[model samples]
Target chain A: MKSLLQNLARWLVPVCFIAFSFSEEPYQLKLAMSWGSDFPVFSESPKRMAERVAKMSNGRLTIDVIGSEEHGRPLDVFDMVRNGEYDLGHSASYYWKGKVPNTLFFTTMPFGMLPLEQYAWLEHGGGQALMDEVYQPLGLLSLPGGNSGSQMGGWFQKRIKNTESLNGLKMRVPGFAGEVLSELGVVPTNIPATDLYEAMSRNVIQAAEFVGPSTDFNLKLHLAAQFYYTGWHEPGAELQFLINDEVYQSLPADLQAILKAAMRASAYDTYVHSVDVSAQAWADMRRQFPTIRVKDFPDEVMSELRRVNERKLVEFADDNDQARRIIESQLGYQAMMRNWTLLSDYSYLESIGR
Target chain B: MKSLLQNLARWLVPVCFIAFSFSEEPYQLKLAMSWGSDFPVFSESPKRMAERVAKMSNGRLTIDVIGSEEHGRPLDVFDMVRNGEYDLGHSASYYWKGKVPNTLFFTTMPFGMLPLEQYAWLEHGGGQALMDEVYQPLGLLSLPGGNSGSQMGGWFQKRIKNTESLNGLKMRVPGFAGEVLSELGVVPTNIPATDLYEAMSRNVIQAAEFVGPSTDFNLKLHLAAQFYYTGWHEPGAELQFLINDEVYQSLPADLQAILKAAMRASAYDTYVHSVDVSAQAWADMRRQFPTIRVKDFPDEVMSELRRVNERKLVEFADDNDQARRIIESQLGYQAMMRNWTLLSDYSYLESIGR
Candidate 1:
């Protein structure tokens, strides 16, 4: 009787397993991204989130990632990922302005919040959930994937004599910064990577900003634009992973965690690598482009730019409800940061004379 | 003549370095937080970041983080960090609803974006810059330093029956999700950690959502509430490292990058550890709380809750211009993600099922 009961219980366990697996239409999701085939983000953080979910359910739940731009161009990533054409896509949010203008705020801004400030606003300031409210109706899930530390201002061709020189100067600027520049009389232009070199060489654009020296040199823009500037307008630029909603819903809980963990790791790597390599890249660019004139924007020009920025912000706030909230939150944090900076950054620098 | 020039250049380099170091003013920064001195989030990331920055710059920069309710309650972290009363602080964003209503989007949301999503929105989606617009005037800077992935729903004394049960229910929730819950009629409360146990035990609050299994189990919530729920409303909850703008600006460029990089590493660790330990904690919880009932919220509840969420969204969007832009950008990304998830998550799962 004991043996029979034991045997029966074992068989019953499998039976129950099968029943549970079919409990609600077996939501098995496969999230494919190019970097890792289907689940590149899994490599960074929420490590093993996907795998854990799969194993817990005894193969009843599974999520796979396809990394690399195997599906399409990096630019096409946001659309492909969001439309459910692919399960997910890993690309920078700044790269998708054609789809969403404000999406670039998540990645970067010209002379805006650093990574930490961005984190505070997103988490405590109702930024993250607001984004979800924005995404869920479209059947998508968004996640922060990676970050690039303060970026080097883009390589430049000629010295910026004054704020006036920036006027009507066609440059490959994107997103809200572009809007701000346009307000400052800059002819902001958007060009894909393939066309950047030709544009600069032909003087179709006077200067351009592309990530840092590592990425900028990769495009060989240093050869065309001999003047390189610092102060990344898009400081704290971040990358993202876009996953389909239904597909994410299908994932087992554990797998979801793994995907998150992996992506976090990847993001760390991206930021670390960017920071470590950019400095070296800048050093190399100096050697490679000996004629490159490195100069900082004049204080007066910067002051004017700041003024224009304030006006544009107010205008944007007036035009867009969401922009108003963001500006309020951003300005709130900046006020605090400025007070802190004045005491710490300013005082320390004064003492050290750097 | 060559030797004299070389000697002059060497002396000039040292003098210039010294002058550069001392040229800037020092700003006072007071970082306040609720965690104990031993807490990793409060202690580790900032220490490493500051140490790394100082070392990289050969002691040209300095950062200090003080912990343990130094400012007041954990709920006050955002204000302290944002107001420049604290040069820096470690806290979750959801705690600051009184000031920045939309800030939670960067942290975690119910069935919303995960850590990766938070990063995505913050880094690429204009989330970072937008938040800066929120914080710049506040004199604050924020970076995501840690994350808790797919947290346990909460510890409850009674099982959640229908969506109606949420009405008038006192629950501890932070961020925009808290607002969503409020829309669903839940009384959202923000409580510091020290008070959670007493509040739950005394029936001051019937339900509470903490981080994950590890943190919850450690806090011994099972002793108070026997019913454990799955399906984390806030998956991949993020923790932020904040710095006063004054403090951040005071640092040298290289030091700033170093600090950013180190924080990135800490943020990565936070997620990895949470995901890894949660699994083990679940097993332990099962062993310890044999009578604990684990249940999932009814589908009807989720659907109804979502409907309420939509109403709140429209209302907020109509009122705030920034919210509107973010909604548009987020909606666009969501649409794209939906298509991607279908192909990657759904299609792959279906194939495996076959």
Candidate 2:
């Protein structure tokens, strides 16, 4: 009788295990991204996230990443995910500025905090909660996907002798930055992404603002102009991941944890990967293009630009209550954190004198 | 007959599921850390890693983190993990430098690469493989556990007048930094961690090197002396996680994936968390301790320190063949990445000039 009862208990345990673990069908999520296929370090975030999630879930959950080229709607990721056409998205938060003005603050700002400092604000200084507040109402969730370090000033057709050289320069700068440049007697124009090379080569635009060396070299923007300027516009541009709220709620707690942890790790890895890629590309650029001049805007020009930036920030505060709140929070946090930044990495670099 | 066959198939499916999932006993690994219990951000990595792993693995694989207080062995983490007394450890690589001289290069060095630069080297510049080469022989695996940004020059009892102020200064600094200081007419010595406050307050040491404000403030080391100098030694110090090779190999592939992913996320999180904590702590310290004065070592002293640091690095290379390889790789990589750093973050800071 004891042997028979033990046998019955063993069979019951297996039955319970199967029903609990394998009863749910394997989950396959469709992810929409802003960039086209194989977009170098930028697209690697979703790819790695998918790979990690599949492994962590023991193949129980998988992600199918579709780039903008395949999806035929690069800029519609926000709409697609919100409408449930895609389970998630990988894109920059600033892309939705027309519809959601607060989204612009989450990415980089002109003369704003660097990546580490910005991350500190986001993670601990209420930036994340503000980000959550903006996205939660739209049935979407946003998290930091990656950072591409600091963007360079631009590839200028001619060497800048002083701050006044930018006064009459025709440049291909867009949106908020364009407005800032316009205040300094410069003519800023928005050119389509595909026309950037042609515009710069033909002197239609005398200078172009792209990314740092990695993506810039890929675009051969430096080939059009050899003078690369150090950046102040977009200090540290951060990419973001967008998840649909309903889809997120549907996952079991374990799977949800796996998804978040994988995304966090992938996000961090992407930043480090960008650092490596940009460093190598910058070195290669210098070696290949011996004429490449890396110049910083003169202190007077920098000081003037910051003054304009501060004025623009005051106008930006009038957008709405939420915008006012985020801008104030970021400014306050940056002021507090900048003291330490000056004392730490900035001071360390100065002391090393490297 | 068909209904009976269907019933049999259901039973067999469960049997297979039981064998594949939840078939083994729950994996509970003992992780020994080098810090005492509840050691703030330093201990948060393993604690969070264990929490994340438990959730990701659905409680099948749980880690029991025992700090040095409970384990009764703070300095023996590497040995404890290797001897199978603990499956893993959280500590600095330099802690093992006395036993394995090559271990000195893994943590931050005097005038070495900063955190991001070193991470770029480790991830893409063959640093991971080189680190593995050093550790694989000891039946241990090491990975970056966290970074505390940068170490500050010790708090001094008296204000520095100039570059020559450090001459004949008695300070409580240990290991490689102590060796470098000894060359510059400063007396360097190591005191136990607990007695640092007493020694500094009693004038046993004129200055003391703890960590940045987060841990340093917690230690109340700043209270004894208020003239804080900027750091040159141990810039961007990174802590490490050590895993026993045999124990690591015993886990299933999915569990291994979960363990690694958790540690990576935890490590990155710890660094960001430190930035936030230190930033906040520095802000609070300035407000609460208005008497505190932050000073930078004069340019002449900084230049001389770098010259001596370069020489010491040459001597460090002669420690072993592997040490030579790591030192060369670090120096070469730092040279390459520092250009980008100067152009990007450094230039950005200068332009903003906040």
lDDT: which candidate is best?
2
lDDT of 2 by residue, A159-247 (tens): 77766888888998887788888888779998876678888888898999878899888788977997888988898888999999999
In model 2 chain A, the worst 10-residue window by lDDT is A14-23
Interface RMSD of 1: 31.4
Best by DockQ: 2
Please write out the lDDT profile of model 1 over residues A289-332, one tens digit for every residue: 77877665666666676677778767767976776776676667
Per-residue C-alpha lDDT of model 1 across residues B185-226, encoded as one tens digit per residue = 889898976688889999999898876566777788888898
Q: What share of the true interface contacts does each candidate keep?
A: 0.02, 0.66
Model 2 CAPRI rating:
medium
How many collisions between residues are there in candidate 1?
192
lDDT of each: 0.60, 0.87
Q: How well is each residue in B302-333 modelled by candidate 2, as lDDT tens digits?
A: 77777888887778787667878998898899
In model 1 chain A, the worst 10-residue window by lDDT is A345-354
